[model samples]
Structure formats: structure tokens, C-alpha cells
Target: MTTTPAVRILAIGGSTRPQSSSELALNVAAMAAQAAGAEVISITGRALMFPIYDTETTHRDPLALDFVEKVRTAHGILIASPGYHGGISGMMKNALDYIEDLREHDPSYLDGRSVGCISVAYGWQATVSTLHQLRQVVHALRGWPTPLGGTVNASVTKFDADGSCQDTGAAEQLAIIGRQVVEFAQMRQASTDATAPSANSGS
Candidate 1:
């Protein structure tokens, strides 16, 4: 009997600051995706620090190239961002801009992939707005946004040093988002595989 390969879920986000709440929240979600049987790859903190995205640059930064490669192969994605001025932080936005490199890929820009999004901010206003913005970005990229997106109000909720969320409800919701992404990715993969021509069948 053969087992199915684990789906690859890439988690990316967070600001420049160390151990940020947004990063911690992303970790929590990534953990949940792992629990749901995905092979999770997290690109956070210093890994996110790359030259700002420019469409006309002849020389591409190594780190930027690495980031693009990960996105190209990931079956799904989970993004967590800190709210800045009622939207996503500049760092997170810049990282996402690197995805433009995939424009020439076969499926292009996250097409046929599930994206789980979360936004962390001091208040509900920023959290909601940032989450909405994230979903909009996912839609523009042609990715499927999970049914449940998370809005974490950091003013009242807290995350532990070990990347665990302190608010039970918030934690559960984030986990649900992660699981949903993994589930959708698996379904999509299975569908694609089923539709492909068999090796033994001659074209």
C-alpha cells in the first residue's frame, strides 16, 4: 500500500521585530497545520528581510530568490501580518510583493492553492481591516482564501514565548484556519492527481 505525500504549507509573515506577536500567531497556525498532516515551512523574522521588491531590477537578491522558490512549490500558504496604519505591515507587504516572481510559473501566483490569513493588531479596527486586506491580496493572486480568517486583537490576547496563544478562543480559531488550509490543499491535490493521465495510458 502506498501513502500519500504530505502537503507542503508555507507560512510567511511577521515584521522585523524579534518574537513579534504576529510571528507567534503564525507559529501557532503553522503548528496546527502540521498537526493536520502538512509539511510546514515557516519563513519568518530575518528570513523575511530582503531587498524591497522591484519589477525592473536586473540583479535578484539570493534571499528574494529563495522566497520565490518556496512559494512556487508550496501547495498552500498561511500568512500572518501585524496591522500597520489599519493595514498590513510594510515588511509583510514587501515579502508578498516577491511573489510576483511567480507570474511566469505554470499555474501562476498562488493559483489553485489555499491561503490561510490572520492579522494581529492592538485593536479590532486594525485587525479587521488588515485581515480584509490580506484576503483581497489572496484573491488578486488567484488563491483560495479559507472560509475562516483570523483577526487577533493583541491588546487583550497574548502569546507565550513558546509560540502558544493564551486566548483559548483565538487559538482555536487560528488552528481551525490552519486545518482548513491543509484540508483544502489535500483535496485540490487529490483532484488534480485524479484528473491526470495515467503513465500506462498512451497519449
Candidate 2:
């Protein structure tokens, strides 16, 4: 008999708005990942108030440390950021800067891990730029990016009064991204296990 390995997914966003589209998208994505049989943990930048990334302050902040560990240990990562100006938000960049800490200490943490990126922007133009920035960051971290990514443009309609999504189509797109991430992660995990030497192989 063989036991299946559980997939761990971490979803995060770059916005601190009270009812941000980025945050809402993360929640929707998490639901999709759960439906796809992956264990999902979602994190919002608004939940924590870690100061901007700085070497001198890391030791003083436990949340920052925890955030880095979550990213390091996750089997798959879903990152969403709002387009600020023409690129990724500064808050998202700040969080990303913290990833540099993992490069030397946890070199293999991101290797082969599945990654997905999403961008929610006020206009259609920002979607491409924001997602592109996220892709570049994930590549630098050495994670595999899923083929399908979620990109929501608000140029079509206003978000709900509560800042939630009113469009069923956008919601479904987010869900699709979640499912894709889990599937990719499972496939990669299987590939890894296949190549790994069994405990009884050399007996």
C-alpha cells in the first residue's frame, strides 16, 4: 500500500486595503486549492504590520520571521498583488525583499515547488505588468510557475460595495488558478518521489 503526500499551498497578497481585490482574490483562490485536495494557508499583508524589509529589524520582529518560514516551507505559493502606478505594490516588494534571506539558508526550499501569480488592477493595462513582476520574482526564487494565472481587471465593473467580487466570472477564474496550482504541485511531487531511492532498495 502507498500513502499519498499532502500538498501545502500558501496564498498571499500585496495590498493592505480593507476590502482589497487582491485579498479577496486570495481567499477565492484558497477555496479552489482546497477543493482540489491541497491544504491551503492564506496570508494577507494587512494582517501583519511588519516594518519595511530591513536587515537591522528582522531580529526584532517575529511575524517577519514566520512569514519567511511559511514561504520557504510551502509546497506551492499563490501570490496576488494590485497594480500600483504601473508595477507591483511597494508592500509586495517589501515582502519579496525578505525572500532574499532564504536564498542561502534554504537553497532547496523553492526548488521544484509549484508557483502561481495573480494581479488585480483597476485597468486592464496594469494586469500584464503586475503579473510579469510576480513571475520574475517567483523565477528568482527557483519555483516552477503554473501555466494558468489569475489576472483580474476592474475596468469592466466596480467591485461590490463591500469590496468583494460581484462578478461570477472573476471568481471562477480565481478558482481555476487554485486548481491548477494544486495539480502542478501534485505532479511535481510524484516526479520527485519516483526518483528518490527507496529505504529497502539496497538490502
Candidate 3:
């Protein structure tokens, strides 16, 4: 019989700006995930002491090491980033580079894991691109990206001062994505548990 693992979701906001749109989007997503019965942890990429990824320091960054450990233990992930020049911001991209350590430490860090992406941008053009890029990054990690990976246009003023999305329509969509991620992660976890061999039962 399949049993579900406790669904632990880790969310990262791409930008570290004081009033970053990425962080705002992540908070909204986190609220929706909490409503869906998942245990969620939010990381600002600020806690870690990672250095910029360079060929020389790639293997020895403490922050990178810490991040890999965190992701390897989580059942699911949600990422929100801001668009910068038609791509993701430098901080988000740098944080993602830390995932490289996981490939060696746990080649399956993302395998069978569920992931969702959200992006906030000044305009729609960069929003979609940033979201797409985030999804691609998750895919490369071997994680399954949810169908509703999102894009939010900050210009719409859809988000409130507290980083909550105030617009009903946009909020609903983001919530749906969060719910989908939790549902998918739970199912995947259950399936993995069911497939593992029992220690006492070779019968």
C-alpha cells in the first residue's frame, strides 16, 4: 500500500530586493500551499553564505553546500523570480547554480519531485520568459514542473503592500498552481514509498 511522505515544500524568491516582486509572489504561493495542507519553508537566499559561482570556487561554497542539503530533503519546491532583461535576476540564477552540487551528491534530487514556478515582472513580455526559464531550470534538476507554472505582471498592482496578491483572478490562478504542486508531490511520495522494498518482507 502506498503511504504519503510528509509533504515538505521549499520556496525561493529570486530577487533579494527590499520590496522585490519575486518575494511577494512567493508569499502568495506559500499561503495557497499552506491552505492545501502542505508544510512549507521559505528561503530568501539570504541565509546562505554562498559566493558567486566561478570555476575556481564551484566545489567549495558553504552556501551552495547548505542549499543542496535542504533541497535533497524536501519533497517539493516552489520558485518565484523577477524578470531582468528578459531573464531571471542575478540572485535567483546564482541561487540556482547551487543546485549543481546536488547533481553529484544526489543525482535524483529532483527525480520524481514536484516543482512549481512563478515570476513577477514589470511587463508581460519578460514575465513569461522568466517563468519559462525557471521551469527549465527545475526540469534540468529532474523535477516535474507543474502545469500551472506562473507569471505575474507587477505593473497591474495586483499585489498588495504586504506582498499578497489582491486581484482575485490572479490570486486564484497562483493558488491553483500551489495546490497542484502539493497534490502532485503527495502522490509522488506515496508512489515512491510503495515501491521501496520492505526490510522484513522478502516473502
Clashes of 3: 0
Q: CA lDDT, every prediction?
A: 0.93, 0.80, 0.79
Order the candidates by lDDT, highest first: 1, 2, 3
RMSD of 2: 2.4
- lDDT tens string, model 3, 92-202? 887777776666654465877788898889999999998889898888878899989888898984667777777878788788888888999888777777887877797
- Candidates 1 and 3 compared: the better one by TM-score is 1
lDDT of 1 by residue, 1-203 (tens): 55789999999988778779888889889999999999999999778888888878857888888888999999999999999999998888888988888998999999999999999999999999999999999999999999999999999999888778779999999999999999999999899989989777988
Q: Cα RMSD (Å) per model?
A: 1.0, 2.4, 2.4
Decide which is better by TM-score, 1 or 2: 1
Q: In candidate 2, which residue ranges exceed 4 Å CA deviation?
A: 55-60, 155-166
Write down the worst ten-residue block by lDDT for model 1: 55-64
lDDT of 2 at 34: 91
Please list all clashing residue pairs in model 3, or write none if there are none.
Answer: none
Best by lDDT: 1
TM-score ranking from best candidate downward: 1, 3, 2
User: Measured by TM-score, how close is model 3 to the native structure?
Assistant: 0.89
- List TM-scores for all candidates, in order: 0.97, 0.88, 0.89
